[model samples]
Target: MAEEKPLTVVTCTAPVNIAVIKYWGKRDEELILPINSSLSVTLHQDQLKTTTTAAISRDFKEDRLWLNGEEADVGHPRLQSCLREMRRLARKRRGGSAGAAAPLSLAYKVHVASVNNFPTAAGLASSAAGYACLVHTLARLYGVEGELSEVARQGSGSACRSMLGGFVQWLMGERPDGKDSIAQQVAPETHWPELRVLILVVSAEKKPVGSTAGMQTSVDTSLLLKHRAEAVVPERMAQMIQFIQQRDFEGFGQLTMKDSNQFHATCLDTFPPIFYLNDVSRRIIALAHRFNAHHGKTKVAYTFDAGPNAVVFTLADTVEEFVEVVKCSFPPESNGDQFLKGLPARPASLSKELLSAVVLEPVPGAIRYILLTKPGPGPQPLDDPNLHLLGADGLPCPRA
Candidate 1:
């Protein structure tokens, strides 16, 4: 290894997405292939996202990874898959014999450093953002590009969705090689410019049961999961797509809520049972329904993943009213918790009658904060070196 070897580095940021059509089970564990195609709205980078930097150099003796300012397991199968695939593609596309990808140091080892703007493993899909950033950033360094979501899918199933903007669907393709299973854009960010996603961070602490293990158990044990994947998903996916195309918030909200409920239902149907939603989650569900009923339509929709947080979806015109409903109902500053954050919106007062009609018990402590955001772009390059997460020494840098 040459101590003075120059390095090639690239850094990029990838947004986090919340599944409206949840992916709960996997048919192939090794490849991280999903049993059903899932759809999600890619969030704006204003709130939750992951930033990663990939540095390749002859001086580096081994490949290493750092996540959120801490050294992570570079040997992780998914991480290795992303790294290996990038190198393979680079070698095949650019590198020549003896693994020379370019005129320079294409065969050199890489050091990856990633950091998330949000909590990890709290069912906010940190892995999705992290892996997407890794794959995108690595591709930038390797000079291999075009539809890299398929490669990202090998790392984390949902991570593929982050590869595109706005509404995305990970098609559960028929091919066994998993080549056809890729993320595709359903609609661009401009399609639903009025739409907003308000994430209620219930518990930022690491999930007691990770999605990987929980979904694995569901695949092995839950017959409901099997039925849902085989019978329920295809039709639901079609309906969801149509709803988005038509901008049918009422229909979309109804289906989104139903799909989330069914996803959790499959969780209960699993042996020994897994509960992602607690009292707070259940209350949020009720509130969404009652709030919609008060207006006689679905003004906002609520969805939950394999964790307790609630993702509330609504339109821009209605966002302020709903945010006030949530704040007045839950009180963000209560108990000294500064929980309300995201998209600047004025507080619209909820009627005393409306508040009474909501008929929900308040549990402010259960919710950590509310993140306000909208749909935005996919993985984007950081042109400025000031934003890079890796140091010139090919090591992790202290976060600003």
Candidate 2:
């Protein structure tokens, strides 16, 4: 009897990172090359992350994907690029084996299954987390090992940093080919256990300008972005790294807020002026400043990405105070019935439904709800067979 063909399965997870020192203005858009170095902290996976399982089986017809339990287009260049790159790396493995026995060069077709803990198109860098998870999982399934930072860079520039846990830096390598452009860790999650991050989801709607388009706009027209890349960022990168190393919350907090402001300033300075933040976002920033000023130093540091959502960072000691202060800053929602019904704050696992009632925190209806988290770890494979996309026979399941 002929032996059954081999099958391969790989699973990986990635956490979302909020840039303390932002990455804006790409030098090469195709390669996702950043004009300046940036730093970010990986958020807790239980709070926000993407887990993906990639498998290869001869039984599969073509490359396919199921994202968050729904069929998604795998032909997208972003998805195609990651799939092709992982396959290339897999082909180069020193000792390749699908199910043992033979040194298989390429034995099966690919299938990917992924899920995100947070809402998609919510301006939470879901794409960064998604792509990073896909590349890492595919690499593991094919018995291929390479520099994770390099693999992630092909997915997303900010994604390279998501490959690692704790505080990471995406070094703006000057090399044109982007070999030197990879993420390096400044500190591990354990290094700063006292820090806490609260994600205030201002809106679940997709940002009008995606990061790629926003970066391009800033690069082409914003003179402030030019100045930031050349003069401002290099100095900030060094100080930010030192701040992380020393666990200096005040120093880190100041730099984070400043960099976030500068990033959006470049957005406003764009030719047509892409506005990612609205009145609600402005109110949150102002409230943070007021609270910190009242305390005589920074108690809570707030940063906004390409969207209106606010990521508030505070030392564990000050979180409750900051949250309370922010709650009072905005007027109650105008809708009488809805205004009285406070937004629920609970873990996602405990709740079956997505938080639908939008409570106006400080800026009425500005924030959807807040996700509480802390520094977290990098990718890990899930042990549950239920999470596997491949069947016991090492073939893609039709249901997957």
Candidate 3:
């Protein structure tokens, strides 16, 4: 092999995905294998994505990480696991484990920089995008030779989907060790080009319940979770894939709404229960139903993860219609309604009894704002060397 390169720099970005068939309860928390199969569409890069640069150098002594220009510890187990896995893959790719050619030390210092265009940990699965970008960039730096999904899965189970663009499925592999539970592409962005998604940034605050902890709680306490995982999702998975393949928006819309409701319902059933959706979220769902019913067709659909925000999906032609509905439903602020004008607004349907129970608290800020998005692609290594995080001496650039 050629002499060890003094510096290696890689830049990559990962797209977020919204599970059409949700990955709710997990059988193996560490392995991240869900009890059931799930499907999602990778979101547009400009709207919601994590851009990352990873590099290695001989001058650096410690492996360090920075997110959005701020120093971040690499000790977190999830982050550590991901970095460890990347290192393992990099060593294997560099040379055989027991090679004789110079026996070059397979170790090199690493530096990472990452930033997210949208909210992080706000039930947007930013980790999926973040880890995916890290894996992709690290793989480039180390010349790791393997399928992108294989590398992505080791970072985070859902992250595997971030390796591929367009519609994807994160199969909850039947294996005990989770080797088979990798993400696969169902369709490319061009496959169904007419799809449009609007991401409402309700309360930019990070989600109180992360997927790992929330899913574990549901698995341990929610009786309905198991049944839904085992019985409900299998059929929904097939139907959803079919809907996407056939471009059946109406059928697809219905399934998206049903699966989202069921996922939240399971959360509500957990011991002591988890309520990610508030009155505002519930109102959005109702408004979606009202709009579709009033139109006599399923022109729009809504889905929510473990947050108060709503991810609204509709055909490109109907996005204006949905936008109009959003503007009419939600209240305007002194800033003169930051939400789009075409979007309609309607009052949230908080039951009188429910509101009375907690009426003292003001509703000064229900949602920070809304984000409009659409289906997008997966991780890619940028060509510009200026995007690199490390310099020729294998030292992290000052900016990094």
Candidate 4:
């Protein structure tokens, strides 16, 4: 038998980003261009992230994808868009060089395997992390470099923001071609060391209305969405940037909550109306407001995406107390140790005055679990061969 062809493989991980200034609608569906500029904080990858591996070989039959161990369609329009763009860019780069030998042949078919550490949907910015990891891994496999936010955006609009670390903003470019509509880093991950994030997973199930579908409906029907995109977001983006730059938690937290509320309100304004927030979600919002009121300041702020899950932002000093308050409000079914995951938070006791001030009936099992994390860097490549998600034969390795 002929010698087996050599395979080139690369593995990388990308972090999820929670939008402070939300991107609710798109101006172009095909290009995944956002209607309004949005800002987001990239969550620490150690707690929440997507890990992806890409391999290319001449023996492979076709371009294929495996997500979370199961095979996924490679022909998905958005997936196809990302694949086509990366290959086109690689081909363009190869053609520009005179006599230099290319590292990998562009003719080889690719197999990609990706898995998210956290829930896939359930409004966790899973698509952003998944697509960012996909593009980042593929870029390494093909030796393509430079700005890749545009390519990632085609897979998922919020994904562009995942291309950078810490605070990021996606500029809703006026260009019809969308070349200028790319994500830019407002600050590095180290910019706000005291900032903390708590993800309260209300439900891990897939959302009833997908973000893409929901956005389209909102764009088609909601007048509020149009006004928010054109009028509100422009000013909010500027103010948000200043707050982050100055390390102003109160301004940042308040703006984050308002933006999230407005986004959901726009959803409600949709023709038939869409409801992503359930009873549990509403309770969490009330708890957050009451807790902040008891502290006589914005001690904690909450933001929800397209699903019922809540992302709470606060400073490092407030994490323990806020986490304690969350537990008291929504008692977890699991043990206290099991209830909290990721970065550790010391146990805190609520005073009688504070407890009475923020009085609310405890809702058992309302929150599935709490993941504690902070701002972290963007997509990172894995250096170890053992970490590759795919085996030597271009198939996914069995989970350990």
Give lDDT for model 2.
0.77
Off by over 4 Å in 2: 1-7, 95-107, 330-363, 389-400
In candidate 1, how many Å is residue 218 off?
A: 0.8
lDDT of 4 by residue, 1-400 (tens): 1114488889999999999999998889999888899999999999999999999998898999999999999999999899989999888887887775565777789999999988898899999999999999989887788999999999999999999999999999989989999999999999999999999989999999999999999999999999999999999999999999999989999999999999999999998899999999999899889988888899898999999999999999999988888888888877867899999989999898888778579989988899999999999999999999999999999971
lDDT tens digits, residues 1-400, model 3? 4337565567887889888888877676665677888899998887677888876666679888887767789887777777777777666655674553432234666778888877788788888898898888877666675676755665666888888899999888888977788888999988888888887666778877777788889999988998898788999999999999999999999999999999999999998789899888877777777777767889989999888889989987877646645654564464545654223443345445433332333344454566676788888778888866556654446765
Off by over 4 Å in 3: 1-4, 96-105, 334-367, 389-400
Candidates sorted on TM-score, descending: 4, 1, 3, 2
CA lDDT, every model vs. true structure: 0.87, 0.77, 0.77, 0.92
- Model 1, stretches more than 4 Å misplaced? 1-5, 95-106, 333-337
Q: What is the lDDT of residue 11 in candidate 2?
A: 74
Listed per model in order, the count of residue pairs whose N, CA or C atoms clash below 3 Å is 3, 2, 19, 0
**Judged by TM-score relative to the true structure, which candidate is superior, 1 or 3?**
1
For 155-226, candidate 2 gives per-residue lDDT tens digits of 788889888899999998989988899998889999998899988767888888888888887889999999
Q: Pick the candidate with the highest TM-score.
A: 4
What tens digits encode model 1's per-residue C-alpha lDDT throughout 1-400? 3224588778999999999999988888878789999999999997878988988888899998888888988999888888888878876775444653353355578898988888899889899998899899888887786779999999999999999989999998878888899999999989988889999987888888888899999889999999999999999999999999999999998999999999999999988799999888888888888999999989999899989999999999998888777776676546433566877877677788888888466765667788999999899999899888788898877772
Q: How many times do residue backbones clash in model 4?
A: 0
Candidate 4's TM-score: 0.98
Say which candidate scores most in lDDT.
4
